[model samples]
Target: MTKKIVVLGVSGSGKSLIGKNIAEKLGYRFFDGDDFHSTANVEKMSQGIPLTDDDRKDWLAALNKLLIDNPTAVIACSGLKPEYRAMLRQGLDDVAMVYLKGSIDTIWERHQKRDDHYFKGRGMLESQFATLIEPTEEEAFVIDIAQDADAVLNQALSLLSES
Candidate 1:
């Protein structure tokens, strides 16, 4: 079955790059979850501020709409909370989430080197990690962020194939 894979992680975890590669290899469409975030939300993050759950309500709803629209597109998102993931899963049975596990230090280093994004400099890392509800045993497959892009994508693809 062609399923929509939602890659979940905090910033600098390589969700976009790895997600696109996984989609390409799996013959699915790739949708960056950031694309679904509202401009004001992005602006808030750009200024090194954390967004409230109220801020994310529409964003999660948008993810649900995305799944409803595309049906089988692979998406990358910082689904940091169980409620957020539940929101995205509304009415979508075929959606599978891949939690990219990694350390804050590692991600902070990557964030320092990262360019062209509003989220950076360890500003939102604590909030994200604090909010993250790692997929339970019955929830989703958890893939560690390995060496590079391809390694991560390979692990995700393998998990998706198994699922």
Candidate 2:
């Protein structure tokens, strides 16, 4: 059976990058949640400001809808809050979350090295990580990201295939 997998974490957690690989390995399409953000939201992030829950409501609703649309695929997003993950999973019973967890040092280093993006800046990532609530053991797969991409994708694909 096909699976709807969500790669989740704070900014710089490599969710999008690894989600793409995981999707490819699983032969599922990949959707980047950043693309679903509104222009205003993008502008706010470009300014290095965090989005309010109100600012995220519409975007989360859209993502939830898209999860419904693609019953079997992989998507990536900073699902920082438990509520946000729940929102994305709403109305999509087959959807599961995979958290790419890592240390502040690793994430901060990656964020600093990340180039050509509007979400670049220092310190704001602290808030993202602070806001993150890791998924429960049963919510989905949990894997540390120090492993190579191939290994991570192999494990993710295995889990997706089993589900």
Candidate 3:
């Protein structure tokens, strides 16, 4: 069985909501990658500063450790760059990546509706899209996010069940 599932997407793509639902369905622990960020990283994002690879090094390492420690977990993370994704899967074979895909315009509208999050604004979304390398079909279970949330969750569960 796939023990580690990482939900990958930019902000406003519903990684957290989808990941949490998936975890609940599978009886696995759920983790929001944003919560593991250092105080400095959160501060930078709150100030509208995009995190560089250097800024993410430690954060990614910590997430990788979380995967290593947990036998069954669903983590919502912005696995944007290829290297970042590769690092996330290092030494792990029973891992599954679910990439929630949507257009910038589609996600931008969602981003606008959110108010309780620190990672807000169109600029931040643009920065994430710019950095995103988009995992290939071979690399992840890709799910379209343009549909309703229930449909998206069902599709994810179906795909994961097959794996």
Best by TM-score: 3
Candidate 1 to native Cα RMSD, angstroms = 1.3
lDDT of 1 by residue, 16-50 (tens): 98888888877888889888889999999988889
Superposed model 1: Cα runs more than 4 Å off:
none
Per-residue lDDT for 75-128 in model 3, tens only? 999999989998898888888999999999999999888887989678999999
Q: Work out how many backbone clashes candidate 1 has.
A: 0
Provide the RMSD of all predictions against the true structure, rounded to 1 decimal: 1.3, 1.4, 0.7
Evaluated with lDDT, which candidate comes out highest?
3
- lDDT, each prediction: 0.83, 0.82, 0.93
Better of 1 and 3 by lDDT: 3
- The alpha-carbon lDDT assigned to residue 157 of candidate 2 equals 70
**Candidate 3 minimal-lDDT segment of 10 residues:** 112-121
Top-down TM-score ranking: 3, 1, 2
Task: Write candidate 2's Cα lDDT for 99-151 as tens digits.
Answer: 88888888887888877788857657876876778887698688787787777
Clashes of each: 0, 0, 0
Q: CA lDDT of 52 in candidate 2?
A: 85
